[model samples]
Target: MEEKSGSLVEWLAPLAFILCAGWLTWHLPAFTLSWFPPKDPSQYDKLSALFARIDVTDSMTGLFGGYADAVDWAALLLLPVFGIIGVRTVRRAPMEFESWKPLDRLAVFIGRLTMMLIVLLCSVMIYEVILRYVFEAPTLWANELSLWLAGFVFLCAGLYAMQQRSHIRIFLLYDMMPRWLQRVCDIISTTLIVTFAFFLVYGGYGEAFDKFYRWETFGTVFDPPIPATLKPMVLLVMVLVAFQAIVNLISDWNAEPVIHTAADDIDQDELDRLRAAVGADGTGDLDVTRGSIQSNTPGKS
Candidate 1:
């Protein structure tokens, strides 16, 4: 029987980890810097801009009027999370990957985040549609939020694509090369990826840092700091992608040579689904009894 990986429970740990990190990412820095609050009392940091300031410091339920309690709890919670789930999900999917190094896990985890963010982007657009059509009062933030999520989604998807080895490659002659030359081609490709990452990060570091420090915004009514977040995120994800490329090179060093043909692009699983959809065996016209039974079932027509 073929298995599917569409279960939500399998994603519980990654979701928890992202949530805990987000909550703490906001609360910790805000509280720690409260003693000598921002040089400008009215200014908002990038995190504060999105969430507004929650003043966890003075809330009775927020614990000791601050984030120490929250941070400590998060630490305790996350330690066991990654440890228990460790390198991968508890219930591995049929196609969920067998070897998950730390970098591989990070890539997969970010890929999942991209999926959730895509859902969030769709939700934001739907909300905008409803407001504009039904309520006649569209939100300023919705479109910008979608753009921001989309930027990160694209970056994360690139990282995921690299890890999955699904990126485009022209292998017309490369496929015919000897195994040693193939490994040579892999090394050259990996080096080129590393070179690209290095130049990108080095050249963009100053600008990304400056924008993050200044909390640069889009200057609209919503005024999201897309510049601040996306700039740094690009560099960070680029580094992760470069490292993942190296990891892939190392992992696949001994992998068997891959041969490409027009038939190779055909998806067996999809064909199986299509076969099931049409109630056909592998030899589509051979199973007469099977077809007759399915045809007789009340809804087959």
Candidate 2:
């Protein structure tokens, strides 16, 4: 019973987020134009007027107007189905990927989604090239679509990097610290990241909400919902990053001390292969010398 309940919750969480995303996408125009209608044109300040100009009024002409019509509801509804697949894929991912927990699984899912976007981006660019050069015709949608996909790719990549523990850090001093001290440093770093994420979500909430409410566009000929969607996405991704940070901190709190050394950094397998290659000539083998050097290197071992 407990196992089944746990599985249900795992499915439910991503479903909730997907539903919320779809709801916001569907109602963004209504919320922006009707719920928080812009003030009178004469009373509008410079910024207000600029924003007002981009607001969607007609639901039958512009991007927002054709959003429901152009969009395939069946395909839109598949987002959660994709999320389910992502979660399952992560759960079964290689051990090196370290996707055991919910947070790690979520990050993997996002990373997989990013990979799909990259492929889509490449395909779009190729199609654009064919149209522009081969057929002597150009497209307005390709560039905007590529940009849109790239933005999400970048955002998802950040989350994936956090999960993989691949982000840059000056760990020179950190590797020298005692185990307890390392834990302390880890706590502090995670705390700072969480605080930053909090501020990002808090400060940007109104802006994101407003942009979505107004159905803000890019003001180009093929104007897209770049501003409206991206604003909210920034906050949403930040929240995920923050959650990953906390998960990492908790998971690694009891881990063994990671003391770095010159030898620790060296790839022994590669060095052995090199030694074998050198010895193939029947000349002096460097394995003994290399072993001595590694033994003398400064480290706990």
Candidate 3:
């Protein structure tokens, strides 16, 4: 029962989170921006834009007519609910966490979110393919939607990778260095990352804000705010990556140094499974080394 509940939560939570996020993206700002007077010559001039960027008046119509914004309220509710579930369900992945404390419930959640996004992206593409090829009724939204989801998948995965310490690193020289020197190298790398994030956020914040405020979009028939959403996300994800790097540095400060080699890429469990499948006969010639699998044509060395 517990496993089933966890599986369901993992599967549905991300979908709900994405839907709620999309709803909030459309409706939340409309209310929050109420302090400022409405502007003219807006992107909301287009019907597609209006749908993408729900106006204060438009949001209250239809099923949401009785409430301030039914969808928005629901979105607000579901976002935190799923997020809390994520936090609760997250487990310590010590292998990935390595020297760090693995206080990465948030990263685990986003990692699941990325998994969900990949599913959604594939669904969108498959939908597009079927509709276009079979039914001859393609959608204008599907391509842009895939692109939009792909953007978040990349960003979220980066943060998750940071938490896992799985991001690419050339440790050849660093592994040979003394502990103090390795610490210095870590500081330098972290500082560079922080510096880059700072400059990028500082410089691009204005543009991200402008795009978000205007609800700038791809201008296709679907007219998604890819520019608005992804621009801000780039800065947001960079900050997160930088923060995670700092956390890693702090947690691993007193830890012994780690060395990497091609052998690290091999999965013992996977080899076990493969050997089981191949049987004892073929296993005699099977060898795993330097991240490569070697075999003889059975009865040969």
- Candidate of highest lDDT: 3
Evaluate model 1: give its lDDT: 0.71
Give me the runs in candidate 2 sitting further than 4 Å from their true place: 1-77, 91-95, 260-276, 279-301
lDDT value for model 2? 0.68
Can you tell me which runs of candidate 3 are displaced by over 4 Å? 1-7, 32-35, 39-68, 93-95, 98-103, 273-301
Tens digit of per-residue lDDT, candidate 2, span 137-160? 989889987887788889989999
Q: Give the per-residue lDDT digits (tens) of candidate 3, residues 167-242.
A: 9898889999999999999899999999999999999999998887766778888777789889999999999889
How many clashing pairs does model 1 include?
1
Q: Each model's TM-score, in the order given?
A: 0.74, 0.68, 0.80
For candidate 1, write residues 189-285 as lDDT tens digits.
9999999999999999999987765556777887666787789999999999999999999988898888998876767766565566555344343
Q: What is the C-alpha lDDT of each candidate?
A: 0.71, 0.68, 0.74
Task: Report the number of backbone clashes for model 2.
Answer: 3
Model 2: weakest 10-residue lDDT segment is: 1-10
**Pairs that collide, model 3:** none
